[model samples]
Target: MRSLTVVGPSRVEWREAPSPELQEDTDVLVRPIASATCDLDRRLVLGDSPFKPPYALGHEAVGEVVATGDAPCGLRPGDRVVIPWHISCGTCAECGRSMPGACRSVHRLASYGNTAGGHWGGLFDELVRVPWGARNLVALPPDVDPVVAAFCSDSLVDAYRTVSPPLAAQPGATVLVVGGTASLGLLTVLSAVALAATEVFYVDRNPRSVQTAARLGATAMLITSYSEPVSGVFDLTVDASADTEGLRRALKSTRPGGTCVSRSVYFTEPALPYLDLYASGVTLVTGPPHATPHMPEVLRLLSSGALDPRPVLAGPYSYDEAPEVLRDPPPGKPAFAHPRAGAA
Candidate 1:
């Protein structure tokens, strides 16, 4: 099997690897049908994150079941499932609270492509393994497009986590999203509008992403912050920009007693203004997205035609092109189409 391997900073290529197998009765071997690059993946490419080289490189993928061991959940060959980015025991206490991203059974940062966890390879592999298959794999709806499946494995679910709870608490609230990480902020706009946020404002320097957010129902703005010292009121503010200044501006724009969610992960200790947050009574939520519990709801919205992320998809490139694309991915969120959909 050939897998995308990161040899060093800004270096990636396809490498041969032994084919994976169903290691346990509850495990399954899947062939990726579609896969994509997430914000975290890009950070690693630039050597901005802590990961070392010579490892399989991907986290988000939608795949077809090639073989399944008989244990309990009756998943069969040909069934499609979205591979969650984290490896977790679905029955753990943290998972019960919808925090599978912090499962106690595995390493705290147990992800497919990272070094902290055991090397389980990456989603870009020709064949991937799913542990505790019944709990980890979210079966795809029959009619959902394969391309949409790839991107939603993490991006859409993370976006759902960013806005769903806040929007639920304050019905018909206004939203402001600061995008820089990747598709996350744009997807947040899509999720917010679908969930009944009255007005949505998106800020980003990338014109392509700004336009994409507009098509998804947000009023896109190119400015990161107000030039004059006027605070624009917003019911909720989400900063997917991993920059420190961007986060500062996002906090300044929030209304008192409103909610602010920062979906970006920081590699360094950023100096944050705790005094302002305490004084304003802002409800702040920031962490790695625990997307396990919300995948079902996001999939439901896609199945009903309420959300279509295909507009943001950049490719269905062949597997032969995976090396170059992973090395130098095109603008916007891109997806690679694999012929493994018919691996059965």
Candidate 2:
């Protein structure tokens, strides 16, 4: 089998790798039918990330079950499923509490597609192993396109976490999304609009993203600076911007008692405006996306046509093009179409 390996900054190549097999009674083997690059994956390929090279290069994918263990799971051979980026035993205490991303049974930060996690092969591989199959795989609806499954694994789910819960808490709330992080901010805007927010405001230096946000029904603004807040306060503000200044702007733009959620990862410790937070009573939420618990709902939205994320998909490139496309990826998310889909 061949897997995409990140050999260095702005470099990737297909390397011969071991084909995965079902190692446990509960384990399953899958062939990626479609895989997409997350914002972090883009950084990794561009050599802009903190993680070093020599690791498998993908995490988000929708795959076909090529083989299943003897254990009775909801899935079987030929089933198309969404593979979560994180690895966890579905029956763990943390998972039982709806925090599968932090499952105590696996190594801390255990996941596919990154060196920080254990050596689970990347989704870009020709074959991959999925442990705890019953708990980790979500069956995709027959009506949904396989390409959409690419984002369902992580990017879309991460954006869902940023907006869905907050909107549920504050119905028809106004939203402000700062989108320097990449596709997340645009997806966040889309999610907010789908959930019926009174108004959605998007700020990004990239005119392309701003234009996309407008198409998604957001009042998009192209800003020259991340240092200053967007025009008005909102019921919910998201710091999808990976920059510190953008995070600060999102925090300061949150209305009194409003909530601000940041979906971007910060490598360096950033200072916050304590006095402003104290006076405004702002609630700030930040952490890795707990996507497992929300995967079902995300699927439900797609199935019911309540959410349409297709606008953000950049390409449906063939598997052979994964290397070059990932190296110089276009603006939106890029998904690769694997050769085998329903192989026995």
Candidate 3:
């Protein structure tokens, strides 16, 4: 088996690796049909992030079950499924509390791609072993395109988290998404719109991004200057921009007593407007999303035709192109597919 491994800044190579095997009765083997890169992966490839190199490079995918253990998982070989990034036991205390990302039964950060969690291997590998398969895999709807659902593992779920709960709590709420993290911001915009935000306002300097957001029904603004926050407040605000200015703007724009969730991963701590947040009584939430719990809603939205993430995706590149394409990824999110999985 050959897995795409990030060797250093701006470099990736196909490394021959041992194929994974089922280790538990609840385990399953899957062949990745479609895998998408994360913003962190782009940063690592561009030499712009803090994580060191020589690790497996992907965590998002839609896979086909190659084999299932004897545990009666209601799944079978050839069934396509959405593989969540986190490795959780589903029955753990943390998972019971809806925090599967911190499942106590696995290594502290147990997940695929990053070995810091455990050497669970990458979704880009030719084959993967899914532990606690029944709890971790979500069967993909037959009518949905696998490539369109590839990001369901992480990115889509993360974006969905930013807006879904808040919008549900405050129906027809106004949303402000300061986007610089590429597809995440746009995906967030799409979710807000699909979930019925009365107004979705997106801020980004990229013309393509702004244009895309506008096409998705957001009041998109291309602001090269972020020294000032967008005028007016919103019921909810999101800092999808990986920049400090963007975070500050999003925080300041939150309506009094409203919530602002920062989806950006700041490797280096950035100075924040503490007084502004305090004075306005705004609640700021940050951290990686608990992807598994929120996945079903995301899929339901997709299945019901209430959401379509394909607008923000680019490329159904062949698996053979991963090493080269990942080195310098495409403009929008890139989806790599197996030649035989019949991905679109």
Candidate 4:
């Protein structure tokens, strides 16, 4: 088997590695059919992040189950499933509360590619070992394509989780998404639209990203200058852009008592205005998305054919080309397909 290994910043190679097997009775082995890069992975690859190198490199994937331990009859060897980025024991206290990203017991819960929690190995490999399969793996609907469903593993689900909770509490409220063409940002746009927000405004300096947002159903604008206060304040603002200034603008653009949700994984110290935030009475919440909690709902929406993520896919390439593609993805989701390796 071959796995994509990151030897250093801006360095990656496809190297021979052992094929994963069930390490425990509660574990399962999956072969990814389609996998895509997370924006965080891009940051790690560019050396702009704190994540160290010499680790397996991907986390988002959709695949078919190749084998299972003493898990449950619900999943089988041939079943197609969407693998979540985080490994969690479904019964844990945190998971029970719909916060699997903060699962307490798992020491360094592994994601597919990076070594944030532990070296789960990258989904960019031939095989992946999933622990607590019964609880973590979500069966994909027959109608959903593995390429599209792969985004659900992280970006899509994260966007849904980030926007839905706050927006649900305040129905028909305005929502603002702050970010450029990042997958998380785009998904935020999609989620906001699907949730029927009174209005979805996207702020980004990248013309391409802003255009993409508008096509995805948001009123896209460039935040060239913030001198004048933004009009039509929002009830909820999501800062998916890893920009500190953008986040500050999001906080300022939000209405009083509005919630600001930040999904950016800032690897470095970003300047913030605490006093301003305090004075505005804004609520700030930020963290790695608890994607598992929103997986079922996102799947339902994708399967309904109402929200299409196809436009978000920039291009597709063979699994062998993943290393180079990750180094320089053109735009949108660059899907990696390995039919022989099975669906992830």
How much lDDT does each candidate structure score? Answer: 0.82, 0.87, 0.87, 0.81
lDDT of 3 by residue, 1-344 (tens): 98888888788888989998888899999999899987877886776765577777789999989998888898888888999988999998999988888899998878888765767888998899998999889988877778878889998999988888898898999999998877999999999998889999998988999999999999999898677658899999999888988889998899999999999977788898999988999999987678878888888888888889888888889988888888767778988877765743
Model 1 misplaced stretches (Cα beyond 4 Å): 224-231, 340-344
For each candidate, how many residue pairs have backbone atoms clashing (under 3 Å)?
0, 0, 0, 12
Tell me how candidate 4 scores on lDDT: 0.81
Report the poorest 10 consecutive residues by lDDT, candidate 1: 222-231
- Cα lDDT, model 2, residue 164: 82
Relative to the true structure, candidate 4 reaches a TM of: 0.94
Candidate 2 yields a Cα-based lDDT of 0.87
User: What's model 3's overall lDDT?
Assistant: 0.87
2 against 4, candidate with superior lDDT: 2
User: On lDDT, who's better, 1 or 2?
Assistant: 2
Q: Can you write out model 4's per-residue Cα lDDT over 213-275, one digit (the tens) per residue?
A: 999889988767433356777899988777777777788887888999888877667777788
Error of 1 at 193 (Å): 1.1
> Comparing 3 and 4 by lDDT, which wins?
3
TM-score of each: 0.94, 0.96, 0.96, 0.94
